[model samples]
Target chain A: MVMPMDGQLLVLAQAETGNALGETAPTIEVEEVGEPNPLTADEQELHATTEADGDAHHSDVFPPFDATTFGDQLLWLAICFAFLYVVMSRMALPRIGGILEQRKARIEGDLAAADYSRKKTDAAIAAYEAALAEARAKAQAMAEETRTSIKADIDGKRAQVEQDLARKLEDAEARIAATKAQALANVDEIAADTVQALVGQLTGEVSQAEAREAVSQVSKE
Target chain B: MADPNTVDPIHQFAIYDIFTLGDTGISFSNSSLFMVLTVGTIAAWLLLSTAGRKIIPNRAQAASEMLYEFVANMVRGAAGTEGMKFFPFVFSLFMFVLVANYFGMVPYFFTVTSHIIVTFALAMLVMVVVIGYGFARHGVKFLKLFVPAGVPGYVLPIVVPIEVISFLSRPVSLSVRLFGNMLAGHITLKVFAGFVVTLGSLGFLGVLGAVLPLIMAVALTALEFMVSTVQAYVFAVLASMYLNDAVHPSH
Candidate 1:
């Protein structure tokens, strides 16, 4: 499409050039006055020399004096400038601006997300700390309760053992006392028998009551 | 191989018809060719670079983006954010001038911006646009630009004329500055290049002497490159400044 249009433009430009030359030829002659057909004779000779230093010198760009060329330059500059301005304003700039804006928004979005995630992490840490602290406190209380109950159970068992030991000792002591009394009574009887034997030997006479009374008196003494 | 006597540095600026209509001196010349070249190159660049329109910038995209940002910053700095509406214009003008200036640095390429008429036309366009914008937006208030903000009543006459003259001179100064920079730099480069050609034709000893001019040309070429870029920047900056005045005309 563009190629076709360019070709069309080329044709149009050629046609326009023909018309322009026809239009400007008489004017160029009138302007020169001395050289009517300036284009004919010296054209090849001038081409032979690179400088073409005969009549028309190179246009000095320093002085902005050439009104004719100025108009032409301005005409083209305007067209070119307008074309550029349109491209820049309508197409190029907006695309760039869009990319830049999108990038900016993306960056801001990422930053915000980061901030939110950081907050979430902070909350999680706080929750974890709180839960850990609570668990520690519960464990400490449970330990205290277990220690107290265990101590009570041990105390009750120790007291029971002590009472049993005391009871056994009392029974043994009572029995020994009874045995001692019995032994003392037996000694009286034995002593009376001995007395009777001795009496019998001496006079052939013995009494159990008297013996017992005597044993009692001896035990009292 | 050409005659050194006939070596005309200013001949590079001559206009010749590409295809003659018959005898019209005014036909599509080298200047026109380069102008079209300038337009085509820029258009292709902008179109191609932004074609993919990726979020991550490629080299061409990055270059275009950088240029955009640079021009955007210039407008924002000079004219504030309001001046950004003129970004496209300023950017176009800057790129065109910059590209044309750089194009001129090529050995045989014609420097379009070297012509005073071209720069003046651009400057006039800026002036026209600014004035049009100012008047369109501000109405009669735009004329207040000629009035100094805090001038005494007795000094109003003197101050107003001076302000008006300065305002009128804005385009002239802007155009002349860019035109002068490009023209001078290119001419200087040409002169040095001419020196090399002229001196080298003499003999072996002369060829050795030509080395000095060749070095100078190389150095001047570097300077011209800088000048080209700076002039473009200055033109854009000045345009923005003028546009700023339009947006916010101080009485």
Candidate 2:
């Protein structure tokens, strides 16, 4: 397909160049009778060179389709590709793979470290909470113990005060009984004196012994 | 029809001798030069960028690594872990085609992959490896690739030939796809660019008229870039899939 197209292009280029040359030849011939045009000569040269280049390229053959060049292309491709394969497989690829692997390993290692740090932080938090709970429990237990000890001391003091109060009351009641008896004896003597006074006032001091004997006999009864 | 003097679209595909190889018909050519350039570019990019091997990648290093992993994953995905053995081969093919395609995008640069022979050679290499490795690994069982598991006996006569033909066409399709895309794209771009040049010479109005083609050329350039990369990826993917067939031929 490309071969035919190139052939057509070649024919067209030749035809166009031929027409240009044919047209310019008359112009140049006519101009030569007067003065040769430098610009026209330059154009002629350009066309000639282009035509020559077209011919050199094998006007009928497309470059890609040119079977003659295949050997060189293949040879060079083999050399270059083989060199490439070697360079890639041995040098370039391995290094790249290593870089990738190293990067992956590094990323994984970093991730794992981060995970470990997170775990350690979690453990620390757990330990802290455990210690906090233990301290709180210890404080609660100490408070309970102090409360019990203070209550026991207060109870003991209250019991001792009650016992002392009972003993004091018993002593006071005994003393009161002794005083009452002495007061009753004094009452009897006073009654006897009053009776003696009354008797003295009435019938003289002769009655003192009689009044005392009467008061003593009445108390005994 | 373009004036051959002003715009020879096919002129770009021409291979001229830079030097000769001792009277042998095999002379080094522009195609060869571009091939070397391709190789050099790939090697330099990969080697120089990864020379740092920093855990945190710079842009070039990241790009290279992305390419590596992309091809690696492609091989592994298509052919499985066992296909990783051919990772280097696939990587080489991918980079070669990719870099060659990109190189072609440079103005006035010879496109190595645009030639049928170059792409065909690369495809042949892939097929050779696949067929060779398949037979070596699986022996006569490699023929089982043509015989799918669930096909009925009667249908196999039809299915088997189709499978064989498809298998045979792998190189053809692979090579032609890259060659055709590169050739057509370059030519189209050249023609459009030629339009701008041809039209712009006419006058101010012609210059104004050339804007459409100029825009088209620009858009085509971007599209060509995409096509180049995509074609390379396609070639690698197909190669890996074919390798998969070689590795596990039963399917």
Candidate 3:
């Protein structure tokens, strides 16, 4: 058992003396001066016969024990407990508490960071949505402008085609009218010639006056 | 060292009884002395080690500094960096128990470790304190220490009782491991030493037998020394494990 330093030494010294110098020796006195006391007859026999490593003075540490009572042991245990509590409260717990408080603060700091991140994330999401809406509006306007320009281009192309078709149709009608006038002129000329010929034939057959009248009437009609 | 046959076993085994209080009894013996010594030794060690210090450590300061670092790292590694919060309590418990165990192993010193009562008391203390800490930290949520994740309602009938029993058995198992190891080792040593005496009284054959036990005893003593340190460490580690469970009840 671990004894108090001052204490075990005293018990050890007494045990050594009794074993080495004999319990019966009269001249031996164990001085506190760290020297072995003189040995006596009975002590010398006990020491020699044992043949124990009697050099280490503390070898006499074994003391008699009786196992019946426990009041003192309980008292010692209680006292030791008190010491333990004191050390725990005064030194150990304070260091532990400081570390714990530091940890709590660190956790709170992280939570605050998470909160800040959430807010920042919300702002980023809002800004992205706004940009998306603005982009949609711009695209819609651009599409509408393109559709208007395409409609204008189609209208211009249709008007140019219609003007070309009308010009061709007018030219075709003028040609047809000219051909009909020429045919009519030729027919009238042919009829006048035929009448003249017939008058000549009648005069020759001795009917000049009647033939002349028929020709004039035919010409007039 | 007495002859095995000549000496009375009861006399040799008798532990000193110092007092009586009515129906109660209190004994101051080798065991009691060691307990007192353990407390004193721990106090002196802390004080002397910290007596003179430099901002940047010298040898003595470095020694204590290493102890602190060792314990801090142990807490961080076993419990997690978050375990640093429990650094002080766990460190002190480790140092105290380890030192006490070492002191008990000294030649001719009465080993308080070989007793179940002492070990159980320590285990119970850790169990109680850890539970209390959990309650303080988590309030009603401390009940989650046993209710593991993903257990369905149908399974709760069988699982809850089993978990509760396992939880309560922590102190018993922890104490028994330490007590049984220490007690068995010391008893083995004593028995082997007895054999040396018994066999040595014969002639040459006796001497040969005695030689074997002598060798065995010496070897076992060395083994015992290692076991003592390991047991102390085991106790401390278990304490930390229990604390971890308490803090992280989700597990």
Q: Tell how far residue B191 is off in model 2, in angstroms.
A: 1.5
lDDT tens digits, residue span B29-137, model 3 = 5567777788777766655655553344467545666666666677777778766676666766677667766775675666665655567767877788778888998
The chain A TM-scores for the candidates, taken one by one, are 0.63, 0.65, 0.44
TM-score of each: 0.83, 0.84, 0.54
Alpha carbon RMSD to native, model 2 = 9.9
- lDDT tens string, model 3, A55-124? 3222222222111112243356556756765785476445444444555687899899999999999999
Worst 10 residues of 3 chain B by lDDT: B7-16
| Alpha-carbon runs more than 4 Å astray in model 3 | A1-75, A88-221, B6-14, B18-27, B55-61, B81-85
Model 1: pairs clashing at backbone N, Cα or C within 3 Å: A17-B21, A200-A204, B149-B251
Error of 1 at A198 (Å): 7.7
Model 1 per-residue lDDT tens digits across residues B123-234 = 9999999999999999999988888688789999888899999999999999999988887787688888888999888999989999999999999989999999999999
Going through the candidates in order, their DockQ values are 0.34, 0.31, 0.08
lDDT of 2 at B122: 91
Lowest summed lDDT across 10 adjacent residues in model 1 chain A is found at A59-68
Per-residue lDDT value at A204 in model 3: 44
> DockQ winner among the candidates?
1
Superposition error at B239 for model 2 (Å): 1.1
